[model samples]
Target: MTGRSGGFGDHSLKTLEESRKTYLQSLRVSTADATFFSHQNALRKFFSWYSPTANKPDSPGNTLAEFAKHLLTTLGQSVDTVAGHIHSLLNFLAFHHQSSPDELRVRLFSEIQLLSCPESAKESLSKEFGFQAGSEITRSVDALRAYLRQRQYGTRTHAYVELILAARARPTQIRLLNRSDLHLDEQTASIPLSETYLIAATGLHNEQTVDLPPDLTNVLETYIEHERKTPSQSGCQPLFTTIHGRASVGTLRRSVKLASEKARDYHCATRETNPDDRSPVDSVTAVVPSDIYRVALSDVENTS
Candidate 1:
């Protein structure tokens, strides 16, 4: 349900356009020419988006949420900008004797207000938020760091390790991430944009940038250039790819779990062979491979 106005090869969309024009004539809205033009354009867009499918009738209900998401993530429009478009949409719905988009508009408007907040304000809000405050863990962050530093890393394995270490992302997040999403030069990586809006709505984050460490950036570059496949080769252009497409969650999980296990084993061997060794190794070796969760929990605490 997306195309240029009058470009839909059918008269129904054209009929909708005529209907919209009639509605505007009847609306007596206290708006200027520019505002009227904007509303007209918004109507055109909505009809274009709501045009019937090949085998099915037009179902605006099925597409409204999707359209809003496309506006937020794909178009990357400011919340206010999108809200303006939605207001016009409400008018269009009213004209059609359809239920207004009030609830959906409220949700979309809330999301926009969140995105519009200053970065400092977002940080302040997160800090002040008490609902998500997590219990403090006893895990040693230094130990986690040491384990990460000592682990062996092939180009592919290293990329996953570094991203998880830095992103604190779940294995599921890797496959959803596109090759184009990594911002190496910026030293910041965005999580999936689809996830970002939800994050903002939930007040977990402000949809601002998330930082990536230099070492992680370097590894990702090496993997993308040397190891990852192009879309033509794999059918999906993901930063991390398998023969099929994006790396599967299992594949991503296995590498980290294996690496962490290896790190723990080495730590255990060191502690056993030299029980009293006065090295950072003693403190670091206490954590098991399974302790990765505690590390992630710690990151969530620190960031939130």
Candidate 2:
């Protein structure tokens, strides 16, 4: 491999900064400014994954394939996203070997040319997150509400549930909520536009403000004034908190799911008690945080 004309000369130079710089410089002339930056970013990420500290791959094609698979399975990237990165990788590899002899190009292309995005990965993702119909979402909301009312649920939990049911807020947005975001006097909550970048990362819908219903506002007022603890000295004052201070998005999600589970159990117990009564048994739906958002969306569609 050494001393070959128009090929990467030294092993050290090939894997280090110089090789990457040469490829990026060649890319700059052929690509648009936006595309050049995109390629640069992709290359940076690829090199990071193929770390200088780690053992270098004998076959770059195999490394690329493994990287693509890692994106889908571990990083949870969409197929289109993984495809885009793969395209960037191909360009980087092709430009590096453009000046090399024909056989090198053939060897490289032979391994990578057949690398197509896997459709099965997308199907697996869909199966992992179960599909919830519109009717199921409504039933889930009803069951959760009935459970909260029947049991001695904490004011904080009850407030968040009521706010989502009324405001149609996403779990991320609700989790990011601060005490200052709530305006009990105005009967509204503000989702600051400044946090849009953070919110967008999680695929949660964000808006300027959400009008809270009177009943919902009252529940929040009670939670804030009584149940909520004093803000920590750490500076970030989250609207929702546990004994430890700010509650994580996972905690918020779990709270909603636990309530849904209890509601289903309660409904089942009630039906068993009155089996001979012959009245219609109320529907109790198992739900997650996303189902609540779907229910909220359904209500908006019905009204509009």
Candidate 3:
């Protein structure tokens, strides 16, 4: 009995032995580039013996199922791992056979059964791949700032960071904001900024005033007057321009990080001179507009 034409035709002892060797080779080659190749290889070898073709007819599908069982029971692979292997093997079969049912479909149900994730395995998978429990927005801000520092971004980059922070923007919002989203009142050097809100609000609620600290305001005013003097591009866009006039999200993120790092280094040096003080000097905290509003409203109530 020989394995030929992409299927096992006979169930003789010699044919079964050949099938086992082929399976072992297949498993070994499948994992050649993977870190867990050796473990997978060993599991396949055990399955070849436990479910020899001579003892049970070798259908492409059944062979896959037997290997899957070996992963679960013999090798003690977690359900997620077993399921992953099964998915890979199923995809391999589907691709090779050019369809789902090609002779291999005979054992598809059993393969699926072997791929079932236990409750414990499900929990483990969730823990490994679940959403992080903190504020993703804050994390994004920190990440962008770190990246900017690593790249040593410049002033335009700082404006971009301010844009995102002031807007309390999500990545998509940052990506979508354009010059149209901002209006420059040169008379007041005030930029009226609009951003998408996570929750719906009353009229014009999504817009926020970006109150730049006096130092930053002065720096920006200088940039706009000295640097952005060139005629506006055909589009009256505010957020991004290829030239020195506006800022892109990538540029902004990088700039924030560079500034943050410089600030940190500066703070560190100052702290070194005053060794008695352990508190971080430039520990900039994100101040969302809502928080500021709440604080201001509380102060007004207290004063009244």
Give me the displacement of residue 62 in model 1, in angstroms: 40
What lDDT does model 2 reach?
A: 0.60
Instruction: Using TM-score as the measure, name the better of candidate 1 and candidate 2.
Output: 2
What TM-score against the true fold does each predicted structure earn? 0.43, 0.50, 0.32
Q: What local lDDT does model 3 show for residue 126?
A: 37
Candidate 1 lDDT over 1-304, as tens digits, reads 0000111235365576676766666443544678668877776666665645444222332234345545666767665665567666644543343222322232233333344344543343233221221232222334334455565433565666556556654345545777666788988766632232322222322222357777777777777768776554634467776776677767766765565556556766766688685555434333322344335434442332
Clash tally for model 2? 0
Q: Write the per-residue lDDT of candidate 3 for residues 1-304, one digit (tens) a residue.
A: 0001133344455554564454445545443446245434544554455444345435555566666556767778876776566555543333333222212332344233444545565454334322221343343345445544344343455444544443333333443455444444421122322222111111122323333345445544544455443435655555434465445555544544555555456545655798796664544334332322223222221221
lDDT of each: 0.49, 0.60, 0.42
lDDT (C-alpha) at residue 271 in model 3: 59
Residue 56 in model 2: shift from native, Å? 60
Find the 10 residues in a row with the least total lDDT in model 1: 1-10
Candidate 1 residue 254 C-alpha distance from true site, Å? 2.0
Candidate 2: stretches off by over 4 Å:
1-132, 193-207, 272-283
How do the residues 1-304 of candidate 2 rate in per-residue lDDT, one tens digit apiece? 1111122334353554665786577557754788778878778777767653465444544556556667877777876776667666654553343211112222333334344446585354223322334665676577688778668344677877877666655566677789988888987777542232322222221244667778787778778878887755578788899867788778878888888888888877867887674534556667887787656544542332
Comparing 1 and 3 by lDDT, which wins? Answer: 1
RMSD score of candidate 2 (Å): 17.4
Shift of residue 136 alpha carbon in model 1, Å: 13
TM-score for predicted model 2 compared with the true structure: 0.50
